[model samples]
Target chain A: MLFEVTADPLHPQPLIDHVRKDESGAVAVFLGVVRDNSRGRRVLHLEYDAYPEMATSVMRGIAEDAMERWPLTDVAIQHRTGRLEIGETSLLIAVSSPHRAEAFAACHHLVDRFKESVPIWKKEVWEGGEVWIEGEPVERS
Target chain B: MKARVRLFARLADLAGTRETEVELGEGLSAADAFRLLCQRFPELADHSDSVMYAVNAEYVNSDHSLRDGDELALIPPVSGGDRAV
Candidate 1:
């Protein structure tokens, strides 16, 4: 499937292969990686969770929306759940189209919408403690 | 009537369980189900106003109607990470 929520670590090459085709002239990929720091704290790792059923459905919707908005040949979105250490790939978004502009726009739209709509969450494990990220109150840090 | 409820992230931590079976009366709205959940797990009351509701995996508002056997979820503000997954 092009849209997924996997506990396994994500590899971008396969998604790139999935979207690559003869008619497509441009391919855009966006990878979200786990960094070592957040808000000045040293992040040890990240733990991701999802309401899987909803997360997959929402991700597909986002991909379809991108396709409708752009002249895209294919869209693939994959997200990782469970724990990921520093530098690991947490998200992969690939879009391919006959032109660079459409591929690039769709790839950007998919990632932005996924973050806003998908039911996935991540918690940053810092040196001493862990806190949920995004949309949560600053007090949580 | 009855409903199955799912909690995630901070809501699940506060409720102490990821899933629960709730008893509800007929014609009650999603709001009523959330209110009853808060009673069962008082820790969730503080977020009653902030948390969103989902029915059968679809996002819904508090006014949405509830039915027997429906799967409901309590969604905290999503934490989709920023700059550092």
Candidate 2:
């Protein structure tokens, strides 16, 4: 299991390779990239900041939850913090399992839950000004 | 009790400091601490509805109990990028 909050770009291949095993014939990976547009505004770049202490703990908890919920061989999650340009890789998740089905499901669950629970904030640097974009809280009305 | 209250992004800017030691009354819950925080920084009042609290590095509900020397963080509604794993 691997969980990290880093400022550097996520190299998915390395993470994927690390979890690859001959017993697990399939490996699934997901990469979230910075896009050029958001909510009809043209975004120039995104600045990601995390409450590191909490962010890592939440991420690790997500990983542990994924393991308990799935029969996966290995799981790795990496998220980049700091300023990133459009098209940059901001987050990566890799999962390996004996079969492809569990790998895909675990990978999706990890990312989805991470977004919903992690304390990460992204600032949208538009042409005019930058606005902080906070992630949704765990509790919602 | 002394708890390190951490603020992130816009909340940090509004609070004027990244982290502060919040002195709380005995047997204070996370919600109680939050009320005091709002009182100290009135700017946070506007966001209290959407804010979430975390204790000991995990997201917790309003009723989560706070102990002495616990680390608490205030998380605001995320608007921009998607969640990463």
Candidate 3:
């Protein structure tokens, strides 16, 4: 498993390649990109920041949870921090399994859980001002 | 006991510093420490309801107990792109 929180744009292809193996017949990748609009506002860009230690720990927990829930051969999650422009890749998730169904399921679950759990925050810089969005604390099962 | 309190994003900007060492009475709960912090930084009082607390890198409620040398992070609102799923 590989997990990272950095300012660099995430390249999903490398992550997909790394998880591909002879025993693994399927790989699923998910990419999250920065959009130009949010809540009716024209967003110029986004600035992401995180409590690194907490974010990483939460991510690791998410990965562990994914592993337990699915028969995944490998998993990689990368979330970008700092300034990001529209169309820039913000996050990437890759999961590999012996079959396509499991790989897709695990990859989707991993990304959803990560978003709901991770401590990384995004600041939407609109044409007029900016707003900070935080995740609601959900009970971890 | 002395605990380190770290602020992130908007909270850090409001506090004007990233981290501070706070000395609390014995057996301080997360709530108590937060109240003391709010007293020191009045601006935080306005957003206390929205702020979230993390103890030792894990999100916790105000009722959570504090330990000596614990790392406390005050998380303000997150302003990132759509959550990846």
State which candidate, 1 or 2, has the greater lDDT.
1
Off-target runs (Cα >4 Å) in candidate 2 are B78-85
User: In lDDT terms, which candidate is top?
Assistant: 1
TM-score of candidate 1 relative to the true fold:
0.93
| Collision pairs in model 2 | A133-B79, A134-B77, A134-B78, A134-B79, A135-B78
Tens-digit per-residue lDDT, A22-107, candidate 3: 88999998888988887778889988888877777877888888889888888888889999999998888888999999998888
Per-residue lDDT of model 1, residues A52-128, tens digit only: 89988888887887888888899888888989999898889999999999998888777777777788888889878
Task: Return the lDDT, model 1, position A76.
Answer: 87
Candidates 1 and 3, the one with greater lDDT: 1
Best by TM-score: 1
DockQ, in order, for the candidates? 0.44, 0.51, 0.51
**Pairs of residues at least 3 apart in sequence or in different chains that clash in candidate 1:** none
Tell me the tens digit of each residue's lDDT in model 1 across B1-85.
7899998887888889999988978788888888998898999898876777789998887889989999998877776534333
